[model samples]
Target chain A: MAPLGDNTNIAEEVMVAEAEKRPVSTIVIIIAMQTEALPLVAKFQLTEDLDSVFPKGVPWVRYHGLYKDLHINIIWPGKDGVLGVDSVGTISASLVTYASIQALQPDLIINAGTAGGFKAKGASIGDVFLACNVAFHDRRIPIPVFDQYGICAKQTFPTPNLLKEVQLKVGKLSTGDSLDMSPHDEAAIIANDATVKDMEGAAVAYVADLLSVPAIFIKAVTDIVDGDKPTAEEFLQNLVAVTAALDQSVTQIVDFISGKSISEL
Target chain B: MAPLGDNTNIAEEVMVAEAEKRPVSTIVIIIAMQTEALPLVAKFQLTEDLDSVFPKGVPWVRYHGLYKDLHINIIWPGKDGVLGVDSVGTISASLVTYASIQALQPDLIINAGTAGGFKAKGASIGDVFLACNVAFHDRRIPIPVFDQYGICAKQTFPTPNLLKEVQLKVGKLSTGDSLDMSPHDEAAIIANDATVKDMEGAAVAYVADLLSVPAIFIKAVTDIVDGDKPTAEEFLQNLVAVTAALDQSVTQIVDFISGKSISEL
Candidate 1:
């Protein structure tokens, strides 16, 4: 009876210590549009908009909510089509991602979105890719010192061992700020061994890497880079499906992150 | 006397026809800060906001004015650090530049700003540089197909003959979307033979190239890359002088663009 009482005290102490330990509390999901982010927002049960938490009246639009013991923020860098061809893309994505990181100090950032895939590389519509690496395909720097414009230094390596738990393609993702990539550009991207092309992944990864934070790009193949089936029609047609797949990928990631300890991640 | 009358009539017709031709009516100058743009804005006497001209309540900020029969538009991407490190440098500049191009359909875009210089490459404080070509030094795209991030295709070759009219060093200007460059990065830049570095030049050039519009970058050396003094201190100390030089360069460019026909340029 006396030994049993002592054992109960030790068990209570351990339980209290575990309760005091904090898990990863903040998570930032960077998506270009409401549609892309909607599924994750819904899946995470994120309902609150912490707009009041930010300073009153700034053009920088931001949203926040709490999910499964984590704070979630969703921001649109700038509006779509307020600019032109490059409107859907912006350096503001990097800026916004950086700002969100600084403010929240997120443990991990998931840049979830859709991308144009290289059909020849076996990227099919509705297929989700977790970026093992990300590069800039359209950045043609003319200097002789470097061979390509892709910033391979910032290649976002996803936790492959952990990623195997999720069923998805893991490969190189190439990002460019513009969408009108020519066939020649497609050849360059393919030559680089990139399977996916996105507008904001590398930019997001670049900032996160600078800050020494881990970021993963979870993208769904919406259109093929050099596929012959009229890019505009294909992209528009597959937009919903890709976004749906993106939501599923983000959910899997969230579940993985939430279930594991930071040390494991 | 009758022959003389006929000659005079022909001269009048030719003058009217030339005026009707309207050489280069629109010029877009994309600058990051209001201070950098102030001199040109003042020099050109740009007094209109043109905010009303855009669809009301859009995030895209713009300034417009009619100067010597040329429409001048200047934009400030985002205020310095509402976002961290990559705040001021944005791909939004490209998007906005493209939008401005589409709206104004400018014949020429002059990306005027201050840059960190390469002293060994013969760059000094207050020295102006006209970008013969622009590349991205930070883009390490580990790929085999493309040669450089430098947009050699849109090489802004100074009318060497016309550039002699204005005294400024002309060379390749390298650009990246970040301010941080280590000694190793600096060495890479030097090896690439890039004499100057800035954030938005390559992006602006990329967009302009896509639209097939001619673009040029004229930058003033504000600080030496990897120089002895702290970059913030050096850049701040030289801000006034660099802006002054930038203003002078813009004046020279304005004079050239204004005086010569587009065909000559």
Candidate 2:
């Protein structure tokens, strides 16, 4: 296979050239998935969280990392709507992520994770997309439009422009904290819903924004809310394709930014 | 002053008592203080939306009456914290006052308002003490292994157990969403570095804990946090007496809940 790479060496050149113009900080890429990180790790021929798992501070598996100038990290934000619902996982993990990044005081942050897709038709498994905006998936204060938006104190930093760059092939995305596994039939009946659903995106944006770090949130679309209830294992198995796509995208994104000028990037 | 009467006579009692006795639904109260709806409005005054100001709607303000039980109405999950130092006045006028007994869900909630009290020998502001538990004001997290605990998800709720309710000399209190301009010290300190600091009590127990319909939160501390630099306006202000009292014991809490049984008084 020729691979998702563009032999034109076009993306890397485009980024490096741009870097010469505008200032670009060392970019960090994070991936969030519900399954094991081995396959993805093997593909890149990189050692995973081996250090953390081997000596074993925590017997249970978890994801956190400090890689190359890329600074990639990974985590499993829990699955099944009710079991691990709420923004806390995202907030807590993001806090750790932010603290780590803040130490370096990087200029930008990029988060990649898996999410549920709710399309009516070709909403197949393992598709990749980018989120434009994110909402608290679990928070639903359904006040009528006639009612005021009321007061909510929140901090959401700007989504990286790189997200906008992928809008063409990937398409737009929406996020909420709740994992809407209501099955396609039931979800279709709901009055309001989003195209993609995930938990961490907004929380990451919030903390990153608070610290003045621009952030990019991307996710692989894994499960479609179909009538037949799929197990978490099934969902993880389906994530393989999307995972490969994510790896390719992150490298390209980094190289692309590398090419840009400091001022213009 | 008159008694609060039995909760049963209060209507929310007749409607909620049965359900609350069981445990299907839970009520939670958060005092953001942005919309100053009368405390009683949640109980008796039924409106589509506060009539004029919110004739249209109030986002999170919920109104649910039991089937065929019209008098049984309660509103909330109101704003979490007061708007800001700016909107404190206009919004508080219509939404808050010390006159009404607003009926909010959650049988037990704490009014966590911001305050400017001194930890300094004579002028430190910013302390969180339980009204009743206020017997002793000084605290450090996990001290006495009981006080100053946080009630986030994955943790057990704080159960004060009506800690020996006493007599009522200064009972029958009301909540105000307005910020008290006292103890200029807080203006010099708070807000600059907290997720939130408002015109109510420690919002911790009120918002995070899962409770029945009898929750109530009251915060009587100062409401603004500038920096250690108090300006001319802050220096001449008389804040000691009131704040000192707010920092006093909660002995009256039990007496207040005395005559009022789970049913009617």
Candidate 3:
């Protein structure tokens, strides 16, 4: 150790190189449940639920780790305000995402999880889709002034260059707080040609858009929305598979971001 | 302070009385913009933007005041995370409301603002509507397993007894982040018999539902969604008048809540 820095030229070069490498300090990945987060948590070798460090939990619970010199945070805002029971619904998803953003102030936010694929749109179970645009199909405001209300008024899409860089399959996604599909609703959703449906994507995207924070939503198909089996059952049955796929997608995304220099982003 | 509580007996009596009286220690009122909050802020004499005191800024900017011994907070989460230009959308409203809840942990949350009334549903401009049950006409999750998704599954209504005590003209509100409406959408909304439409009510209600926090949504009719004029134009033209009405409604609501004892609630 005493002679380690004796090579002045090499030490200086090493320090300069280290300083030149742009690092991603914080990247927040939000998911609805611990199960959805487990894969990423394990893959990233996170040993702590950051929420535990704070006796009074913050709005979002973050699990921190380091991957390839980049800081990674897997966040889960349980169904309750901070922590309690696991809750479902768009509102919960949106609130937790908001809390995560406020608390972490991360450089990038990613919502990665499972969704019901629209088979007609060539979506199949296990396929991962990157959101080109996210719309809330359930926002039905019936008025004469604005048609955008019926659809999520603020449809969020990744910037073109990011898409070119990520080079993932792009698909429009429709999100709502529903586990089942009705004929009329299905028609409306299909009419928009969305490739997938999930409870949280649109809500997450909506928050990111409002904050002007760049977000990428990656969802793996869990089941078909209108398949013969009930969506709840199908979703439950395929959670492990879907989560695995989602974990992979997130890992790739993290690698890509970690590989990039600050200037490139 | 003249040794206000010098006497142990009197202090005990006063403390008991205070404990018995159901005081709303924190009442969080969320509105989309400053204009919507103007009436309440003026009425309550909140001269300081609580954010100013923190310097670093809280998740949601809080305006402080007192109404009949009840703490009042008027909050707005502007665009761009915590601060920036005010944004009008479902996402912003939901996130801000969530942040407000996290920051204030208020005993009660009220979403006060203007909304579009459905003339066919017996609504007219300038009228105040208290939310009995809030549903999202736009959350049309047309799936088989979970019909609630299409209808915001948790359609929160004040306990029947509370509604009776409040004695306000109660109506069901449909919320979405849109300023305009189309004919088809209008018909669908009308079919649902929603009396009013606004951007933030449903989102707030959705959050309140998750937290099991009691929330009241008070809105003044700013325009008729299917009225002769465009909703945008009508909303802008009538904002002052509508806000005035909304202000009055919030005042009344506060008075009602302040007047109630914990037992009454």
Candidate 4:
């Protein structure tokens, strides 16, 4: 948490035991997976939290920065690489990398990533895979698909209470083993399911479940099911849709956090 | 979904699905993220589900195969660098990410990354930061802490249920903003946290709440809090620690997925 600098400091949020302040009721943490943390930070109005830094929190740190005028410290878990691809799947490896995120007493958490698309009838590149539910496409038992569920892991995922509570258009998500580039096949896979194929959805879902935070996972289909790679690589504009959606979601989440959505706290 | 060649197809657990013997519940897909997927083909296992060709998820693709398997997949909503250092503060993006993951139906999840330790505590160049709970670290209001608990996004993270049910051991975790990698500060941050630092845990926690999956998130203290230049390049062991932890986490996660221990899985 310290390596991220004062910008990621949570010391400001800490209530001095002597202060005798109210116990924070609704604390939320936001994680932006994959790409760098610049774009998201660009949209926020930040105010440093000066009191929290010291022997307890990060050194050379300020209080904490604000995002969208909301309160919560942020971290960029960093671009991922293989921890042990030989033993664990990419998704599983990702889940264990941050084994202590649960330490923070957060009522809610979220994971966001860029995903490839399966050529679904209505699905196209840059579409947000607003996962209604996520599953391992690669996992399969020795059983046939027509009979029973495949060999899926037992890990849990983040809850989507806010996902449903917030009114927005969403597409289901499907997990896949490989990056889908073929329009025809991706289309077929999307045709089979009502979502997009991403690398981290299942992993994030698994972690959130363990933490018991009401999670709301979402992804922006970066490219078409077979959108030419390198052809569209430069754009990476796929995140734009996700950002747009996030911009919209903030209003609702903030409303809920402030107790304005359900009942004024 | 189609890139997986049909050559390798193995099942771990078996059950009678549709009256036919099949894997109980598991699916494994193999792909290359940043480092290219071909060389690793030899590392492929029999318990894999190939797409079509032998060693074929997407036959003849020269992908970098980036991620080496970090334990947690903290998907950031930042696409094309729209965010900044503390961009992960917003729960909206994180919540959206959580919703995408929930669709997968995992049982547990977590986030891990590199963080800067700002203090001169035990934060070592290659230690880790383990957090018991995440504090917004930034929400400072004029009202008393108790009165404004609603305004703050500080909270606690839920434990991984499977780990509890199965009894898995957990290490340390911490939170902060500074990437304390100075030989002294690095040791301090590492001594204090676990051995890592990075942003995104809080968001991951927030999303995990929605999914109901327990999780753990920690970052390898990559650099010192007071130093600049990303210490990632300066320290070798610090880099190693993250990868090692990531590897350790991969095995654990796989065991969780396989319903077996690291050795058994």
Residue B249 of model 2: what lDDT?
Answer: 28
Q: Give the per-residue Cα lDDT of candidate 1 at A264.
A: 55
Q: What's the lDDT for residue A188 in model 1? A: 53
Q: Rank the candidates by lDDT, best first.
A: 3, 1, 4, 2
Top candidate on lDDT is 3
Model 2, range B1-265, lDDT digits (tens) per residue?
0112222244644554564344323222233332323332333333433432221112234333331212222333343222212222112212221101232333333343334333231223333333321111111112122222211212112224433342112111111122322322133223121222232332232222211224333333342234453422342242433333332322134224333433321
Model 1, span A51-98: residue lDDT tens:
433222212345677767677776654332212111234354665665
Q: What is the C-alpha RMSD of each candidate to the true structure, in Å?
A: 16.2, 20.9, 9.8, 23.8
User: Can you tell me which runs of candidate 2 are displaced by over 4 Å?
Assistant: A1-23, A30-90, A93-102, A142-168, A181-193, A226-234, A259-265, B1-162, B165-265
User: How high is the DockQ of candidate 3?
Assistant: 0.20
lDDT string, candidate 2, A68-180, tens digits: 33434443322212233221233333533444354355555666777666666334566666555444332222233211121222323333455456431343344332243
lDDT of each: 0.64, 0.36, 0.67, 0.37
- Model 3 residue A90 lDDT score: 67
What is the interface root-mean-square deviation of candidate 4? Answer: 26.1
lDDT for B72 in candidate 1 is 77
Worst 10 residues of 1 chain B by lDDT: B78-87
lDDT (C-alpha) at residue B77 in model 3: 56
- Higher TM-score: candidate 1 or 3? 3
Query: What's the candidate order when arranged by decreasing TM-score?
Result: 3, 1, 2, 4
lDDT of each residue in A1-265, candidate 3, tens digit only: 0011222476654653553355556788888767888878889997666435321323346688777777787777643432233445566577666666666776677888888888878888888889777776655444432235346534454445445665456788887665556554576577667888887887777666544455778888888875687777788789897888788878877877776643344
Sorting all predicted structures by DockQ, with the top scorer first, yields 3, 1, 2, 4
